[model samples]
Target: MSRIGKKPVALPSGVEAKIDGQTVEVKGPKGVRSFTATDDVTLAVEDGALSVTPRGKSKRARQQWGMTRTMVANLVTGVTDGFKKELEINGVGYRAAMEGKNIKLSLGLSHDVVFQVPDGVTVTAPKNTQLIVEGIDEQQVGQVAANIRAWRKPEPYKGKGIKYVDEYIFRKEGKKK
Candidate 1:
């Protein structure tokens, strides 16, 4: 009894969804993306709508079926709306630059650190202190942003380092003498 998988996904105008065997290809005005449904999850396009049907009510079948549907829906929406993540450098002299398909960061260390960017992901740094990660895949976009933030996490005491714009660092007050 999966509530979400039971609902059909309406195909927006200018968006085309088709099934090629086990893979579902969705093409929209923004871009194109595809996904292969897992076992027990059937994908079909009917009357300009995409639907996912579970083979049975077993735990594995229900879980995979619903997960596949959610992932497929995300893939379709990501290609159309795209995804973005923003990070800020808090420490003084900490900055970043785009260098040869990699992001070069100087986080108060003696040497610069360079992180290679995977294919299909775009890293934009309008300002050295600001980082913008954009991609069609939501998972990739978020993972890249998290990895970048992990390089020099913000310290609770000083709150200096790389962190998301909305992230909050819980600070513990110093003990009184």
Candidate 2:
């Protein structure tokens, strides 16, 4: 019944997948990643592809079937192409710069916000207003971008703040004079 689960994840050339019980490990040119599925689902590598199947007809099993399959697919993509997130500062004085392993952000605050870059992720600022977050782990890349954006969310009126490059801010009408 799960459309996503029914489709097998194809392993491209130069990418290798290993299965050990409920855990699946994938290694590619970019990096290596692994995922452990719950006992409600089964993981198997067959014919240069990975598949997930529920162990029973229970609701939990069906839910895990799809979720587990997606997780495995993410692991493969993470190890191969990796992930990236882009953010842009919109305020006049707001800007971002890389400081060694940390990022220095000026978001119209009293003091510059220093964000320490965590391991396994890289943050770069090609332009003062643009920030690029890249990492092999999709979750880490997204979380880092979110943490950076949380520092200065775009306002509805002026739209002055930090936001994703593709994000749109809903503007509101100003108070009547």
Candidate 3:
């Protein structure tokens, strides 16, 4: 009954997928990633594609069907195209720079904030106000970007802070005495 679950994930050339019990492991040129689904769903790789099916008519099985299928698809995509997140810094004297394996941020604070880059994820500052985070794992890439943005979230008044490149800040009118 899940539309997404009904579709099989196609395996491209140079990409391989293997199924072992409830776990699905995908390997591609970029890297390898695996996902373990719950017993409510079954996994299989056939016809150069991976598929997921519910084990029963129960609600839990139905719920897991779609999620499990998406997880497997993510594993395939991660090992192939990978993921990226961009951040923009907006504020006077606020900027970012790459310091070896970490990022140094100046958010108009008393002292600069040093964020350590985790393994499997790369953070690069193309410009003083721009940061690019990339990794084969979607979750890690997104989390790293979020953590960087957390250092100085955008404020509504002046819209001065760090935010996603595509993010929009709702500005409020200043006080009119």
Please, what is the TM-score per model?
A: 0.90, 0.98, 0.98
Query: Between candidates 1 and 3, which one is better according to TM-score?
Result: 3
Q: Cα RMSD (Å) per model?
A: 1.7, 0.7, 0.7
lDDT of 1 by residue, 1-177 (tens): 888888888787888887887798888866788888877888888887788998877889999877888887887787678889999998879999989789999999889999999988999999999999998889999999999999999998888899998888897777689
Runs of candidate 2 exceeding 4 Å displacement: none
> Distance (Å) between predicted and true CA of 146, model 1?
1.8
Colliding residue pairs in candidate 2: none
**Model 1 lDDT-worst window of ten:** 72-81
Question: How many clashes (backbone atoms < 3 Å, residues ≥3 apart in a chain or on different chains) does model 2 have?
Answer: 0
C-alpha lDDT values of all predictions: 0.87, 0.92, 0.93
Candidate 3 lDDT by residue in tens digits, 22-46: 8788999999998889999988888
TM-score of 2: 0.98
Error of 1 at 125 (Å): 0.8
**How many pairs collide in each candidate, listed in order?**
0, 0, 0
